[model samples]
Every structure is written in structure tokens, then in C-alpha cells.
Target: MEASPTLKEQVSILEEQVGTYETVKSSLIEIEEESDVTEEDFSGITFYSDASVKLYDIDSAYINQLLGTYAIVRMSEKN
Candidate 1:
């Protein structure tokens, strides 16, 4: 049978995967923010900032989490 990867090897592979995921997530977020994301871009209804601003990728849980974190940062700054 084939041998499994050593702990070190597994960790290295995981780290690389994490790095790739981070890069893709960052790009997706940037695209969402720069361009207006429509319903076609996401499966759910898009988000809006007040009445004039629009949030991106409303259907993505990751995007929602990022927005929540961003709000927390801004709120902290105000205080």
C-alpha cells in the first residue's frame, strides 16, 4: 500500500492550500467591492449600504463574515 504523508509533509501541504485559498478569497472580495455585484453574481439577494451603496456577493457566507469584521473595525475606530 502507499504510505501516508509524514506530519511535516502534511503540514506543508496544508499551509500551501491555505495560502492559495487566501489569495483567491482576497481577489473575490476585491472584485465584489470594485464592481457592482448583481443577483446573477450571487445566488441570494445582494446587500446595500444605506440607499446608495451596494455590497457584493451577498450569497457568499465568507463575504458576509468579511463585512461583519470590517464593520467591527470601523465601529472600534469610532469609539
Candidate 2:
């Protein structure tokens, strides 16, 4: 059996996967300016942004939540 990653480890891995940290940060700031999300709304949430984003092995419920919140311009499956 394999052990699951800790929350900190998951966050670190997500950060590495989303290399454009500054770009994502700026985009989040812009989103905050345009939307009703406050700093408290962002607590314990991770933001990943890129020109062409790819998310692997994510939970369907979480994906649906993201889609509900943000506009996904493009998406495709690979398997």
C-alpha cells in the first residue's frame, strides 16, 4: 500500500506543477478585483493558471466545482 501525501506536500507539488506562480497570483488578484471573492474566500484554496492548463487525476466533484466557479475556455481528455 502507498501512503497519501500530506496537505503541505500536496500544495508544494501543486505549486511545482503550476510553475507560473506569479502569473496565477496576478490573475487571482484581477479576479478578486472583478468578482466578489475576498481574501477569506481564498483561504485554504489553491489556484493554478496557465496558457494551456492540464489537470490530471483530480476528483470529478472538485472539477465540477471549478467549472462552476471559473470559465474553462478549453478542455480535452487524454487516456
Candidate 3:
């Protein structure tokens, strides 16, 4: 997936399958915004998985972010 399609390529393909270029481009923009993921600093993890773990990835990322934020608050309280 690293070599995924560029935005232009995706738009062109989608337009061909769906409708007009402008309409497809606008729809893609809206969909992208609706499905946007928050960026976070997640700890490196390694384990064997049958792909179910993939579903937990976003949940765990947010948990990691919350834990980091809590740690920062605790440190500030100590100071």
C-alpha cells in the first residue's frame, strides 16, 4: 500500500467509475475529511496476528496518546 495511487490518479479512477470530474473530486474531499484519522505518537509494537489486531490499532493509538497525556499531567503536578 506504500506505493498507493496519487490523489490525481485516485480522482481520475473514481470519476471514471462514478460521475463528473468536479463532482468526484468534491466527494473525495468531503469523504477524506469525514474519514480523517488523528495523528499521534504511538509506541512500537510487534506480535503475531491473524489480522484482527488491525481493528484495534486505532483504539490502541488513542489509548497510547491518552496515557502519554496523563503522564505529562502527572509530571506537571509534581513540578
Candidate 4:
């Protein structure tokens, strides 16, 4: 039988994954900024779906708040 990873090993794996995610997120933000996309342009972006419920059709203010929270958390991880 294969041995499961220890607690420390699992933590190390998770940390690596987080680091990779942060790097990708940072790169995406940099690209968007360099592309001269305005905040309104970014926020107005939407996804189209044939389903009964459309996510983008919901309250945009809440979506912006969530995005702001995610940016803050990502920034905090740098320290």
C-alpha cells in the first residue's frame, strides 16, 4: 500500500500550491494593468450563458466587493 503524506508534508505541498497561485494571480493583474483596462471596463465584463440564472446579471457591487477582498488577501500574503 502507498503511504500517505505526513502533516508536515501535506502543509509543504499546500504552501507550494498557494505560492504558484499567487504568482499567477500577480502576473494576471500586471498584464491587465499594462493593457490599460479601466476599472469600469473590467467590472463591466460579463459571461454569457444559456442557463436560467446568469451570474453577471446579479448585483455588481457585491461582485466588486468580493474582488476587492481577494486582492487584499493576495497582497497580505506577500508579507
Candidate 5:
């Protein structure tokens, strides 16, 4: 017969997952901060998710510039 995980074991697993999630989330935030990408709540902007947000085709140069901020920020970077 297969033994099921105990409650404590389950909790430990969940806690580990939570810890990993926190690390990943903080890493993402750090990446954003380091890149100087100022992303305000998109909810406020009119046509933010509707008309303004492009899906498939985006400007490669702009994206590259945004990513480049991760290397060198402040000198030539903006939100």
C-alpha cells in the first residue's frame, strides 16, 4: 500500500513552494527595478489593456532598450 503524506509533510512541501515563489517574485521585482522599468498599475491607464496593449507584434528596438537597462541604468534610462 502507498503511504500518504502526513499533514506536517504537506505543510513542509507547501512552505518550500512558498519560499521558492517568494524568491522568484523578489527576483522578478529586482530585475524590474534594476532595469529601471517603471510599470504602474495598468488598470489606471485608459485603453491600457484594451487598445494600447499590443499583443503579437511589438517594437524590438524598444524591448531591447528596456532590457539593456538591466546592464547600465541611470545614465540613459527612463520609465
Candidate 6:
């Protein structure tokens, strides 16, 4: 049988969310603010000379939980 993830493993996964946020936050392209995201953007979108923005498929609810975007539950998926 497969083993469940240990506490250390779970913590590592949680830590990765912070790294992901920082990486995107520091990027020059402000995806939603600068350009409209299309279905293609979800695959891979490029801008200007060299920046490429690809939307990775992570669960929106998980992201909301990680970022703590609300007082209770997720506000909306409209973003």
C-alpha cells in the first residue's frame, strides 16, 4: 500500500506556495493588470521581447486558502 504524506512532506508542500507567490510577485509582467488572459494564456503567453507567462494549473480554492483572500471562505473566482 502507498504511504500517506508525512508531516514534513505536508509542510514542504505548504512552503512551496510561498515560493510560488514570491516568484510571480517579482516578475515584471503584471498578468491581470497588464494584459487580458485568454485560454491561450493558460497554456503559455509571451509579452514584449522575452517574458513568457503561463498559467499553471493549481486549484483555485487551494490558492485562496494559501493566500487567505477572505475572512471566511473564498470570495469569488472572478479573478
TM-score of 5: 0.24
TM-score of 1: 0.26
Question: The CA-based lDDT of model 5 is what?
Answer: 0.74
TM per model? 0.26, 0.19, 0.27, 0.29, 0.24, 0.20
Q: How accurate is candidate 4 locally (lDDT)?
A: 0.80
Q: Write the per-residue lDDT of candidate 6 for residues 1-79, one digit (tens) a residue.
A: 7656797698788797997878877896655656566555444654454346566799988988878856444556543
Where model 4 places Cα greater than 4 Å from the true spot, the runs are 1-56
Cα lDDT of model 4 by residue, 1-79, tens digit: 6656797798788887997888888888743235565456566678777786756566989999999999999999998
- List CA RMSD, all candidates: 19.6, 21.5, 20.6, 24.3, 16.9, 22.3
Model 6, position 34: C-alpha lDDT score: 61
Please identify which of the two predictions, 4 or 5, would achieve the higher lDDT against the true structure.
4
Q: How accurate is candidate 3 locally (lDDT)?
A: 0.75
- Lowest summed-lDDT stretch of 10 residues in model 3? 27-36
lDDT of 1 by residue, 1-79 (tens): 6656797798788887997888888888734356575456455778776979776656688888999999999999999
lDDT of 5 at 58: 75
1-79 in candidate 3: lDDT tens per residue? 3644687798778778775766768877743355467877566766667866554346888989999999999999999
Residue 13 Cα positional deviation in candidate 3, in Å, after optimal superposition: 56
Provide the global lDDT of candidate 2 against the true structure.
0.70
Worst 10 residues of 2 by lDDT: 70-79
Best candidate according to TM-score: 4
**Model 2: pairs clashing at backbone N, Cα or C within 3 Å:** none
Q: Write the per-residue lDDT of candidate 5 for residues 4-26, one digit (tens) a residue.
A: 67977987888879978888888
- Model 3 Cα displacement at 47 (Å)? 39
lDDT (C-alpha) at residue 65 in model 4: 97
